[model samples]
Target: MKISARNTLKGTVKEIKEGVVNNEITIQLAGGQEIISIITQTSSNALGLKLGKAVTAVIKASNVMVAVED
Candidate 1:
């Protein structure tokens, strides 16, 4: 898979929450960090995402925002 995204983290599928139109995927990184992504149900099924499966989290964005409680 060749793409323009440079921030790719390899991890294992930790959990999957299937919804009506989308599915939430949780990936656990080597350092114990977890990243969650929500994708379309169709795409999720096509990728065959499952628990314990090795996968890569591709991160591509123009802007990333951080938040804090006031």
Candidate 2:
């Protein structure tokens, strides 16, 4: 599939929190980093998301905030 977003990362499904209308999915990348995505329940079911399943996280945003402490 073609996408405009470039921030795609390979990860494995770590957790799935199902809701009535939406499902919250957590993916664990290499080195134990984790990312969470809230997607539609229909889409989640279509993808058949489950634990330990390999997936890719695509991040698209207009603004990303970062902070550092010294």
Candidate 3:
């Protein structure tokens, strides 16, 4: 898949949390980092995401904010 998103990380599906309207996907990167994404149930089913399945996490955002403990 090709898109304008530059931030793409290769990882494997670690866990899947099914919800009524959406599904939570957890991907574990090579460096042991985990990224979670929430997508529509239909989209999740269409992609066929499953445990141990290889996938890519694409990140596209207009602005990213960071906050620290006060």
Candidate 4:
């Protein structure tokens, strides 16, 4: 999945933690650093986020957001 963010970290997905009813998936990096990313509200195809899968985690600042009008 190509996500547009500030930075990207190339790593393997080590594990997945899913709740009882479509909970968020917590992807663990190869280096043992776990990052919790929300599965998009519209994504329901089950992209099979599994272990040992090569993936990229987009890193961005939390304080970056603003509202605008057209």
Candidate 5:
């Protein structure tokens, strides 16, 4: 599939937390870092996400905020 997001990271499904409306998904990147995404339950089921499954995290955002500790 074609996506407009450029920040696509390949990762493996680490965990899946199911909820009534949404599902929390965690993907572990190559360097051991993890990214979490909350998607609708229907979408989650449509994708058929499971542990150890390889997936790509498509990140498309208008603004990303960053902060530094004092």
Candidate 6:
């Protein structure tokens, strides 16, 4: 597989909030930061994203965009 992702942030799984079936999961990062991604409802178990579980948030610089309107 041609996978290209960079900029990884290591943080513990503060809290895993579940949504609807096969819905997105909220990933809590270090420094009290939160990120939401559309992942399987079972992702929590697959990645062991429970409390105190160390996980990495991979974010490519280019993949991230910033915007501002005045």
lDDT of each: 0.91, 0.91, 0.91, 0.62, 0.91, 0.69
- Between candidates 1 and 6, name the one with more favorable TM-score: 1
Off by over 4 Å in 1: 61-63, 66-70
Worst 10 residues of 4 by lDDT: 39-48
Model 5 weakest 10-residue run by lDDT: 58-67
For each candidate, what TM-score against the reference? 0.85, 0.88, 0.86, 0.51, 0.87, 0.62
Write the residue-wise lDDT of candidate 5 on 1-70 in tens digits.
7977767889999999999999999999999999999999999899989999999998876545568999
Task: Record all residue pairs in model 3 with backbone atoms less than 3 Å apart, i.e. clashing.
Answer: none
Clashes (N, CA, C under 3 Å) per candidate: 0, 0, 0, 0, 0, 0
Model 5 segments more than 4 A misplaced: none
Estimate, for each residue in 2-46, the C-alpha lDDT of model 6 and write its tens digit. 357866777766665677666555567777887765667776567
Off by over 4 Å in 6: 1-3, 23-28, 68-70
Those runs of model 3 whose alpha carbons end farther than 4 Å from true positions after fitting are 66-70
Tens-place lDDT per residue, model 2, 1-70, is 7998768889999999999999999999997999999999999999999999999998766545677998
Q: By TM-score, how accurate is candidate 4?
A: 0.51
lDDT of 1: 0.91
Ranking by TM-score: 2, 5, 3, 1, 6, 4
At residue 69, give the lDDT of candidate 5. Answer: 100
Best by TM-score: 2
How many Å off is the CA of 49 in candidate 2? Answer: 0.6
For model 6, the local distance difference test gives: 0.69
Q: Which window of ten consecutive residues has the lowest lDDT sum in model 1?
A: 58-67
lDDT tens per residue, model 3, 1-70 = 5798768899999999999999999999999999999999899899999999999998875534578999
Model 3 error, position 49 (Å): 0.5
Better of 2 and 3 by TM-score: 2
